[model samples]
Structure formats: structure tokens, C-alpha cells
Target chain A: MLRYLAKKLITLVALLFFVSITVFAVLFVLPGDPAQIILGINATPEALAALRADLGLDKSFWGQYREWVGNLLAGRSHHSIHYKMPVFDLIVDSLAVTGPMALMAMGFAVLISLPLGIYAARNQNRHGDVTVMFFTQLGLATPEFWFGILLILLLSVQLGWFSAGGFPGWAADPIGAFKALLLPAFALGVIRAAILTRLTRSSMLEVLREDYVRTARAKGLRERSVIYVHALRNALIPVLTIMGLQLGQLLAGAIIIENVYFLPGLGRLVFNAIGQRDLPVVRDIVLFMAAAVVVVNFVIDVAYAYVDPRIKIN
Target chain B: MNTPLLGIEELSVGFDTPEGKARAVDRVSFALERGETLGVVGESGCGKSVTALSILGLVPSPPGVIESGAIRFENSDLIGSPPEALRRIRGRDIAMIFQEPMTSLNPVLPIGRQVAEPLMVHRGLNRKEALDQAAQWLERVKIPDARRRMGDYPHHLSGGMRQRVMIAMAMVCRPKLLIADEPTTALDVTIQAQILALMVGLKQEMGMSLLLITHNLGVVAQMAARVVVMYAGQVVEEAVVSELFGRPFHPYTRGLLRSMPDPAGRPDGGSRRLSEIPGIVPAITEAIVGCKFAGRCPHAFGRCREQAPGLFDIAGGQRARCWLSRFPERRRTDA
Candidate 1:
């Protein structure tokens, strides 16, 4: 198992390297001037040249690439021309809002969908099954931004249960921050829960038909225990696969929902950085998203080993 | 032998398909006495397994239902019993083990949990106590290092060992009746003998009645006291194991016996071709007015095609469903 994890770790590093290079190449070719965006029209040529040199914007393409790589390896971050702060600190601040929201959305998805899916599969073709399927279909159909707007309208605008948008700092007041993030988290979570429930239902249908489930019933286990303990645990490998993919999607897909809720997040930072031609932040954050996906996939592979002992990691 | 432990009266289990109702088990009736092993024998699709499933209340319902029947166990009718009542009886008064040992257990759960399930359910023992008792049961089933092996998953054990674990799980609660459906069909030849021996040994040790269902006549001879011979969803004949082997009354039973190639019976002391029953076990999707096995019975006659034969007693608790065994004057008898 250790050897398998070590191999995956090496692959993850290689993949991150490839992703960083791709992000750098794509950003380099885009038509933009960071110095121009930072200095504005009133700046003199001398001031602009000094600013360009200081920012490393005046270096050759390869020279700038080498400097970025060196700074990354040495644990230093270039100053963000847009934020006027260290890029690391800015990225971390944005993620503080985005990370919890994504995790909360994920927890909501698992808690809601796992049972819904299993219940639908068990009831299968009855009224309960049809109702759950109908809602999941509707959830899958609606867009995340539209869902977010709908939640804002219902909870924030109409009910006045929550403020309309913008995050209060978590460190300032944990409860208020949770309340502020709830609507947006639920909004992002609905579509994922819909997709996950469908996957869970189908996967559960297959596992429920397995011979082992019959034996479980023959043991006189309660129908509920048979479905949840025996059937659900076996059905998890496939559901977990879909969940791991959805997590990376949540992290990257946060941009639109974050925009809708006015929640400060990394996706938004990357979006604004792209328009401002802030090279360091854009490249780093994109790399981070790809790394997030790769890391999540690796963790999922390990989880598979736990769910099914028959799976040999090697 | 006088008082029966389980009695199935005119049980008809069918499935609803697009075309019509598919009668998988047609009006099957039989009885098993206390501490007796009654073997239900037939070809692969002959409804032997269905009968067992129906008794255990495990058959899938929408497509499958008990069209008509009564299953009397311990003075209570199990056929239409409430789920709560059935749940209480199942694995406490009665328990079942299936054919595929390798697949009949949860692959993820530890073996200890699977063995202790019945004890926890029926006995209401706590997890730790149940597990301790489960370890002892595993030891009785001859699993080495029983306590330590409790942590192993189903996939970690060999097929024979898995079957032994399945047996351990089935017997943990000391059920009054134990139904084993083709329990040894999927094992190595030598391992088959050992598992069958272990089952018989366990039955004797616990003094519990056993319903041993198998297609193998050889297996029935070793494990069963009396045997019910089924053909195309109906019981064609039933007798003491020796009586059925010595003199098979129905043509179907005769064909089943002839199909087995005996080395001692070979002509000129050399190998010879084994006789086979000509036709497969046919399905019952449409209405039937005559004997279901008449098409495959070599001695099928004019009356055999016109009406189903009733089970008639020949002697000493022996019964065969055939017109040829009855007097030529006998007619219109139905069971």
C-alpha cells in the first residue's frame, strides 16, 4: 500500500508540473500587458520601466518562467500587481471563503443524496421512487447560477432568513459566517446531489440484486439494515468515484456560483486576475485547481481499496 | 417420523411476466419430520430452489408471488404471516444457507459479523458476546485460528472455507429447521464430500431437521433419509432414499437413475455411455391440462397426455405420480 501511494504521489507531482507548464504557456500567449494595467495612463516611461523591471515583466519569456519556477521551489511568491500583496496571501484569503463553502456543499450532497438514492432504489417503480427521481431530474436540469439566484430570492429576498450576498469573515463570527454561506452552499449542492443520487440509485439497484444481499435477507436482517449496511457499503465504490470527480468540479465550478452570491473565492480571483493580466496568480491558481483534481482522484483510489478488499493497489 | 416439523400444502409459486403468469412451482406439497434430512431432487430448472425460497419468504414479489399455498411451521402458517412475525421466526426458528458460498456473503464485512448476525438478531446478544460465540462456531467449523480469522473478509477465504463459514453462520442460532439449497454443488469433488460430511455431522450434533435440496442423486443418498423427486415444478415421486434408489416408480425417476453412469454396472467391465433423460425441464407459461413431465416420460400413454396424474401410494409411505403404477381400471384420481 505504501508503495502504491508513493507511486501515485510521484504521478501527482509530474501531473502538477505538466499542468503548471500548460497554464504558464497559455497565459504567456494571451494578448495582455500587466505593467500597463498596473501603472495606468498617467505614469511616465521612467516609472513604467522601473515598475516593469521590479515586477520581472521586462524579462525574456524563458527568463520569467525560470524566475517563477525558482520562486515556487524556494517558497516565495511574486507580488500580485492587481491585489498589491503577496500572491500566496491573496490566494489563501480567497480560498478561506471558497474551501468551506465547497466542503459544506459536499457534506450536504452526501448526507442528502446517499439515503435518497438508496430509498429510491429500494422502493423502485413505486410512488416513493418516482418522486425522488422526479426531483433529481429537475435538480440535474437547473443551472447552478440559476439555482443560486432562486435560493437568494426565496431565502434572502422573500423570507429575509439570510442576507442577500457577500461573506462575513469566519474568524469574526462562526455562526454568522455559516448562516451567510448556507444559501450559496445549498445552491451549489443541489445539482451535485441530484447527479449523485441518480448514480447512487443505479449503483444500488445493481448491488441490491447481488446474491450476497439475498443471503443477508435470509439471515433475517431488517429490510432497512439490509439496504443500508449490506447493500450501501458495497454500492459505495461507484458512488465514491462520482463524488471524487464532483469535488474537483465544485472547486473549479465555484466561479459562477461565487459570482452569483458575491462570495470572495479563488475562482473569482482567477477570473479577475485573468482580465487584469496578473500572470503569477492566474497560473498558480489554475495549477492549484488541477492539483486539487489529481489529489482528489488519488484519495478516491485509496478509498476504493478500503471499500473492496479484493482491489489490489499494485 | 410421525409428527411433521414442516408441512407445505398445495403450494403454487408463480411469476407475472408480460405474456402471463409463469408458474415456477406448481402445487408442490411435501412434509419433513423432526431431525430428518429430506432431499428435494430435480434437474436445474425444476423449481427445487424456488420451493426453498418460498418457504423462507425470500422470493421477489411483483414478478413472483405465492399464487396459493400454506407453509405450516411450528403450528403457525408462514405463507401469509406479517413481516414482523416472519422476521422473528426467520433465523431464529428457521435459517437457510444457499448454493454459492463464495458470493453468498458480504465481501466487505468481516467474517465475524456475518457469523454473529443470527446470534445478534434472534438471541439479542450484544456485539462483543455475539462475536465471541461466533469465534467458537467458526472453530467448530474447523477454521484454523478462529478468533484471529474473524477479521478476515469473505474474499480472503477459499471456496470450501467460505462454505464452512456459511454453515457456521446458518447454525449459530441452532434453528429448529435448516434449509441448505445445493450447498455442495460448487466445490471441488473431494471438498464436496468433506462439506457434506460436515453438514451431516453438524445436523446430528445440533439434532435439528434439515431440508437438503440437490440435483445430485449421489448427494441425496449420502445426506437424506427420505427424498422428493421433482420434475417440471411438480413432485413426481417421493420415498425412503433406499426405496427410491432400489425401485424408482415414475419413469422420470427411472430416467434420473439410469442417467447416472455406474462403474460397477459397466458391460464387460469397461466404460459405457450413460443414458440421459431425453428432454429439458420445460417452463410453465401457459395453461396446462395434462402431466407436466409427460413429454419427457418415455412410458407416457394416452391418459397421461389427457390429465395430470395424482400421487398414489404403492407401499410403506412410498408415492409416485403415474397412471402405469395404478390399476388399469383406476381413473379420474387427482392429488
Candidate 2:
């Protein structure tokens, strides 16, 4: 296990390096001048040149990339032109919203999917299964942002159940913070639950038919034990695989939903940074997103190994 | 006769498919006496496993339903019993092992935990106590270093060892009946013999009735006192093991016997092509009006094709479902 962890850690570093390169390369190819944008459009060429030199934008692409990476590692980092703070600190603030919202969305999804999926699977072909399936189909068909908008309209606008959008600082009022994010989190969570419910249902359906489940039943185990204990664990392996992939998706998917909710998440930060042409913030935020994806996938692999001992990490 | 431990009467199981309801076990009836081994022998898809699965009420529904039946165990009706009632009887009063040991046990669970599950569920033992008892079961099944081996997953065990674990699990509750559905089919020949031996030993030691379901005639010959032969969905014949082997009255039974490879070399000393039953078992969905084995039976007469024969007593505690068996009435008169 230690060897597996060490191997994963090494890959994580290499993956981060690759992600940094991709982010840098894409930004390098974009037709814009970061220094000029940071300075004003009416700024003199001398001022622009001095800003470029100060920012090290005049250096070769590879040379600039190495120095940027080295500085990031060495604790010397670039500041966001728009935010007027270090890029690292700017991203941390963005993540503060993104992390909680994503987790709450996923937490809600799992809460809904696990029971709904298991219930649907157990009552296969009955009204319970059909109804859940029909709702899931509707959930799957609706775009997450559209779903969020519909949620906002129904819950916040119509019923006044929750605030429409925006993140209240968690430290301010914990109850209010949760209530504020609830609608968006639910909006994000419902669509995921739709996909995950179907996944869990089918996976559970297959596991329910396995011989061990039969053996479990033969042992006169209660229906609950047979379904939840024996069948669910085996079914969970596949569901968990998708769940890992889905977590990363929820983060990326938060981009659109964040816009819809007016939430000050990384997605919004990236949107604003790109519009302002704050090269450092955009690059840093996107790099963080990429790193997040890599890290999520690594955690998933570790989790899969823990759930299913058959998985041997090389 | 002593009261049968389990009496299955007119039990027919059918699975609903897109096409229609396909009957898998058609009005199959059998009685298992206490401490007696009953071998149910048939080819693949002949409903051998389904019969065993139905006994536990473990056949997955929506697709499967007991069309009509009575499964009486300990004076209680098991068929259409409440889920709680069935669950109480299952794994407690009766336990079952399956055909494929490779997939029969939970892969993620420790072999010990799986073996101990029955004890925990039925015996009301705590986790620590149940697991300790599970180690004893493993040791009983002759798993070496049973205590230390408790933590290893199913993947760590060999095929035969896994089957032994399965047997251990089934017998852990000291169930009145242990239904082993082709438990040794997935193992090598030597391992198959060992598993069979182990099961028989466990059955005798536990004083449990054994329902050994297998397609192998030799396996039946070795382990069973009475043999019930099923073809397609019907019970084609039933007799004492020696009597069934000595004189198989049904043509399908005769075909099965002929198909068995000769353990002792033929006089010519060269391997001969083994005789096959000639035709595949009819698919259950196809509406067949006659004997399921007629197309495969060489002696299938006009009556065999036009209608199915009911089980007929062929004298001396043997019975066969065949038109030929009916002729014995006139033969006895002529004699």
C-alpha cells in the first residue's frame, strides 16, 4: 500500500507538471498581450515594455514556464493584476466556495442516488422503479444550468424556499450559508443523482443476481442484509468508479451552474480573470482545476483499492 | 415411512420473458427424508439449479414466479411465504451452495466472515464470536491455518477451497437440509471427489439431509442413495441409485447413461466416440406438446410426440415417464 501511495504521488507530480505545461501553452498561443492589458490600453509603449520586463513576459515561453513553476514551488509567486493579490491566495478564495458547493452537491447526489437506486433496483419493473426512472430521465435530459434556473424559479422565486444564488460566507451564519447554497447545490446534485441512480440501479440489478447474493439469501439473511450488505458492496465498485469521475465533472460542471447562481466560485473567478485578461489568475486557476482533477482521480483509485481488494495498484 | 424433511408438491416455476412466460420447472415433486441424500441429476438448463434456488425463495422475481406449488418444511408452507418467513427459513433451517464456487462467495468479504454469516444471522452470535466459530468451521472443512486465514479474501482461496468454504457456510447454521447445486462442477476431477467427500462427511456429521444436484452420473452414483432424473422441466424418472443405474426405463435416462464415458477401457483398447444424447434440450419458450426428450429419444413413438407421458410406476420402487412404461400392463397380462 505504501508503494502504491508512493507511485501515485510521483504520478501526481508528473501530472501537475503536464497540466502546467498545457495551461501555459494554451495561454501562450492566445492572441493577447497580458502586460498591455494589465497596464491600460492608452498606456505608453515604454510603460508597456517596462511592465512586460517586470512580469518576465519577454522571456522565452519555456524559460518563463520553468521560472513560474520554480517560483510557485519556492514560495515566490505571481500576483493577480485584477485581484491585486498573489495568484495562490486568489485561487484559495475561489476554492473556498467551489469546494463546499461541489461537496454539498455530491453529498446531496449520493444521498438521493444511493437510496433511490437501491429502492428502484429492489422494486424493479414496479411503480417505484418506473417513477424513479422517469424522473431520472427528465433529470438527465435537462441541462444542469437549466435545472438550476428552474430550481431557482420554483424554490426561490415562486415558493421563497431558498435564496436565488450567491454564497454567504460560511463563518457568517452557518445556517444561512447552507440555505443560500442549497438551491444551486440541489440543482447540481439532481442531475448527477439522475445519472448516478441509473448507474447504481443497473449495477445493483446485476449484483442482485450474483450467486453470492443467492447464497446470502439461502443463508436466510434478511432482505435488507442481502440487498444492502452483500449486493450493495459489490454494486458499489462500479458506481464508485463513475462517482470518482463524476466528482471531477461536478467541479468542471460548476462552471455553468456557478454562472447561473452568481456564486463567487473558481468558475466565476476564471470567467472574470479571462475577461480582464489577468493572465496570472486565469493560468493559476485553470492549473488548480487541472490539479484538482488529477488529485480527485488519484483519490478515486485509492478509494477503489480500499473498496475492492482485487484492484492492485502498479 | 418417517416424515419427509421437505416435501415439494406440484412445484412449477416460470420466468416471464419479453416473448412470454417460460416454464423452467414444471410440476416437479420430490420428498427428501431426514438424513437421506437425494440426488437430482440432469443436463444443463434442465432446471436442476432452478429447483434448488426455488427452495430457498431466492429465485430473482419479476422474471421468476412460482406458478403453482407447495414447499412444506417442518409443517410450514415455504412457497409464497412472507419475505420475513422465507428469510427466517432460508440460511437457517435450510442452506444452499451453488454451482460456481468462483462467483458463489462474496469476493470482497473474508472467507471467514462469509462462513460465519449464518451463525451471526441465525445463531445470534456477535461479530467476534461468530468469526471465531467461523474459524472452527474452516478448520472443520480442513482449511489449514484457519484462524490466520480468516482475513484473506475469496480471491485468495483456490476453487476447491472456496467450495469447501461454501459448504462450511451452508452447514454452519446446522441447517436441516443442505442443497448443494452442482457444488463440485467447477473443480478439477480430484478436487471434485474431495469436495463431494467433504460435503458427505459434513452432512453425516451435522445430521443434515443433503440434496445433491448434479449432471454427473458418477457423482450421483457415489453420493446419492436415491436419484431423481429431470429432462427439460419435468421429472422424467426416480429410483434408488443402484436400480436407476441397473435398469433406466426412460429413453432419456438410457441416453444419459450411454453418454457417460467408460472409466474401464473397452476391450478394443482404443478410445471410442462417446454416444451423445443426440439433440439439445428444447428451449423452454418453444411450445412443446409432447415429451421434452422425444426428439432426442431414439425410441420415441407416435404417442410420445403427440402427448407427454405422466410418471408411471415401473415396479420395484422405480418409475419412468414414458409410453413404453405403459406397455408393461399388457406384458404382465400376457405373462
Candidate 3:
């Protein structure tokens, strides 16, 4: 197992290197001048040159990439031309918001999907199955942003249950911060719950047919134990894989929902950075998202060994 | 005589398909007395396995259902009993093992936990106590280093060893009735003999009624005292193992005996072909008005096709579902 973790760690580092390179190169390849975008074209050549040197754009591509990577590895960050703050601090602050929100969304997704999926699988071809499938279909079809808006309309606009948008600082009020994220988190969770529910149901259906399930029943295990303990444990393997992917997706794709709810998150930071051509923030956030995905997948692969003893990692 | 430990009266198990409802076990009835091994033998698709599953109420539903029957275990009717009641009996009063040892065990679970589960579920033994007893049961089944192997998953064990684990799991609770459905069919020839011997030994040790289902007549001869020969979802004949093998009454039973391959060569030192019963068993979907095996019987005559034969009591505690058993003189006349 240690050997397997070491191997996965190597792969993760190699993968992140490529992601960093691509994030760095893609921005450079795009039609934009960070210096010009920051300073108007009317600025004097001296001013432009000063800003270019300050931002390190005056350096060669290789030199700039090396310096950027060196700074990242050292836990130091370049100044954001747009926000005028250290990119690392900005990202950490955004993370403080997006991290909890994304995790809560994920928790919501798993909570909703597991029970609904198991129910659908148990009552397959019955009214309960059909009803669960119908709701999941609707959830899958509806966009998260639209769902977020709908939640605002119902809870905020009409029912007076929650504020329309905007997040209070976590330090001032933790409960308020939680309530601020609830609607957006639920909106994001609904769509993923739909996908996960479908996956869980299909996976459960297949596991239910396994010979061991029959053996469990023959052992006089309660139907609940047979389905939940014996069958669901095996069914969760594929679901875990999808869940890891979805978590990464939630981190990267929360830009629209974050904007919709005005929750100062990583997604909003990246969006504003892209508009202002803040190279360091954009590059780092994209790399962070990629690294998150790669790392999550690595964790999932290790978890498979824990869940199934037959999978011996050499 | 006291009531049999297990009795199935007119059990009919069927499956619904796109084609129609196909009967797998058609009005199959049998009794298993205490400490007796009753072998239900038949060809593939002959419903022997279905009958075994029905005993524990483990038959897969939707596709499969008990069309009609009463499975009397002890004093209660298992058929139509509440699932909770059946569950209480399962793995406690009765237990079952299946054909594929490789697939019948949960791949994710440790074998010791799998074996110990019934005890925890039925006997309310805690994990440590159950594991201790399970280790002993594993040793009884001759698994090497039983306690050490408890942490190993099903894939770590060889097929024969897996079968041993399955036997350990089923026998752990010391059930009153044990149903083994083709338990050793997938093993090596040598492994098959060992498994059979282990099962017979364990049955004697536990003093439990054994319902052994298999298509192998040789296995039936070795493990069973009384045997029921099934053909096309119905019991064609049943008798003491010796009586069935020595003076089989039904033509189907005779065909089954003749089909057993002779290990010794022909006296002339030439290769000899093993005799096989002609024609395949009829598909259950096809409605048969007369005897289900009549089409495959070499002695099939006018009345055999026109009317079904009932399981008739023959002399010496044997039962034959053949008209000839009623009147031996009719054997001379062809249709």
C-alpha cells in the first residue's frame, strides 16, 4: 500500500507539472497583453515598460515560467495587477469561502443521491422507482444557475426565508455565512445528485444480481442488511469514482453559481482575474483546480484498495 | 412416523418472460427426514436448483415466483410466510450453499466475516465470539491456518478452499436442514470427491438433514441414501438409492443410469461410446398435456403421450411415475 501511494504521488506530481505548463502557456497564447490591458494604450512607453518589468512580462517565456514556478514552490506569490494583492493570499481567502460551500454541496449531493438511488434500485420497475427517476430527470435537465435563481425567487423573494444574495464574513457570523451558502450549495447539489443518483441506481441494480447477494439472503440477513451492507458496499465503488470527479467539477465550475449568489469564492476570483488579465491569479487558480482533480482521483484509487480486498496494489 | 424435517407439497415455481410464464418446477413434491440426505438429481434446466432455492425462500422474484406450493419446515409453512418469519428461519433453522463457490461469497468481505455473519444475524453472537466459532468451523472444513486466513478475502482462496469456506459458512449456525445445490460441480474431479466426503462427514457430525441437489448420478450414489430423479421440471421417480440404481422403474431413470459413462472399456479392447438419453428436455414454456418426459422416452407409446403418469407407490418403498410399474405385462407391448 505504501508503494502504491508513492507511485500515485509521482503520477500526481507529473500530472500537475503538465497542468501548470498548459495553464501558463494557454494564457500567453491568448490574444492579450497583460501590461497593455492593465495600463491604457495612451500611457507613455516608460510607464508601460515599468509595468511590464514589474509584472515580469519583460522576461522571456522560459524565464517567466521558471520564476513563476519558483515563487509558487516557495509559497510566495506575484502581485495581482488587477486586485493589487498577493495572488496566494487572494486565493486562500477565496478558498475559505469556496472550500466549505463546495464541500457542503458535495455533502448534500451524496446525502440526497444515496437514499434516492437505493430506493429506486430496490423498487425498480415500480411506482417508487418511476417517481424517483422522474425527479432525478428533472434535476438533471435544470441548470444549476437557473436552479439557484429559482431558489432565490421562492425562498428569498417570496417566502422571506433567506436573503437574496451576498455573503457575510465568516468571522462576524458563522451561522449567517452557512445560511448564505445553503441555497447556492443546494442548487449545485441538485444537478450532481441527479447524475449520482442515476449512477448509484444502475450500479446497485448490477450488484443486486451478484451471487453473494443471494448468499446473503440465504443467510437470513434482513432485506435491509442485504441491500445496504452487502450490495451497497460493492455498488459504492463506481459511485466513489464519479463522486471524486464531481467534486473536482464543483470546484472548477462554481464560477457561475458563485457569481449568481455573490459568494466571494475561487470561481469569482478567477473570473475577475481572467477579465483583467491577472496572469498569476488565473494561472494559479486553473492549476489549483487541475491539481484538485488529480489529487482527488489519487485518493479515490487508494480508497478502492481499502474497500475491496481483492484489489492488491503492488 | 414423525413428520419429515422438510416437506414440499405440490410446489410449482415459474418465471415470467417475454415469451410467457415458464414453469421451472412443476408441482414438485418431496420430503426430507431428520439426519437424512435426499438427493434431487436431474439434467440442466430440470429445476433441481429451483427446488433447493424454494426451500429457503431465496428464489429470485420478478422473473421467478412460487406459482403454488407449501414448504413445511418443522411445523410452519414457509411458502407465503411473511418475509420476516422466513428470514428468522433462514441461516438459523435452515441454510443453503450454491454451485459456484467463487461467486457465492462477497468479494469485498473477509471470508471469516462472511462465515461468521449468520451466527451474528441469527444467534446474536457478537463479532468476536462469532469469529472464534467461525475459525473452528473453518478448521473443521480442513482449511489450513483457519484463524490466519480469516482476514483474507474470497479471491485469496483456491476454488476447493472457497467451497470449504462456503460449507463452513452454511454449517456455522448448525441449521436443522442444509440445502446444498450442485455444491461441488465446479471443482476438480479430485476436489469434488473431497468436498462430497467433507459434506457427508459434516452432516453426520451435525446430525442435520441434507438436501443435496445435483445432476451427477455418481455424486447422488455417493452422498444420498434416497434419490429423486427429475425430468423436465417434474419428479419422474424416487426410491432408495440402491433400488433406483438397481431396478429403476421409470424409463427416464433407466435412461439416466444408462447414460453414466462406463470407465471400463468394451471387452474387445475397443473404445466404447457412452450411451446418452436421446432428445433434449422439453422447454418449460411449451405446455405439455401428457408426461413431460414422454417425448424423450424410448418406450414412449400411445398412452404415454395421451396421458400423464402419476407418481405411483411401487413395492419396497420405491415410487415410479410410469404405467409399466402398475402392470409389468404392458412393457411387452409397443404403442
By lDDT, who's the top model here? 3
lDDT to native, each model: 0.88, 0.86, 0.90
- After superposition, the stretches of candidate 2 with alpha carbons farther than 4 Å from their true spots are A158-161, A172-174, A251-253, B266-273, B328-335
Candidate order, lDDT descending? 3, 1, 2
Residue pairs whose backbone atoms clash in candidate 1:
none
Q: Residue B249 in model 1: shift from native, Å?
A: 1.3
The reply for model 1, stretches above 4 Å from the true place, is A41-54, A312-314, B265-267, B327-335
**What C-alpha lDDT, on a 0 to 100 scale, does residue A125 get in candidate 3?**
93
Q: lDDT tens string, model 1, B1-335? A: 35589999899999898888888898899999999999999989788899999988988877889989899997789998998888888788888989999899999999999999989888999999999999999999999899999999998899999999999999999999999999999999899999998998999999999999999999999889999999878999999999999977888898888888785866677776788878776667857677877787666678888988899897898898888766544432230
Clashes of each: 0, 4, 0
Give the per-residue lDDT digits (tens) of candidate 3, residues A130-192. 999999999989989999999999999999889899899799989999999999999998889
The DockQ figures for the candidates are: 0.79, 0.83, 0.85
Which 10 residues in a row give candidate 1 chain A its minimum summed lDDT? A248-257
Residue B22 displacement (Å), model 3: 0.4
lDDT of 1 by residue, A5-38 (tens): 7898899889988887888888888986677778
Q: How far is candidate 2 from the true structure (C-alpha RMSD, Å)?
A: 2.8
TM-score of each: 0.96, 0.94, 0.96
**Which scores greater on TM-score, model 1 or model 2?**
1
Question: What residue pairs clash in candidate 3, if any at all?
Answer: none
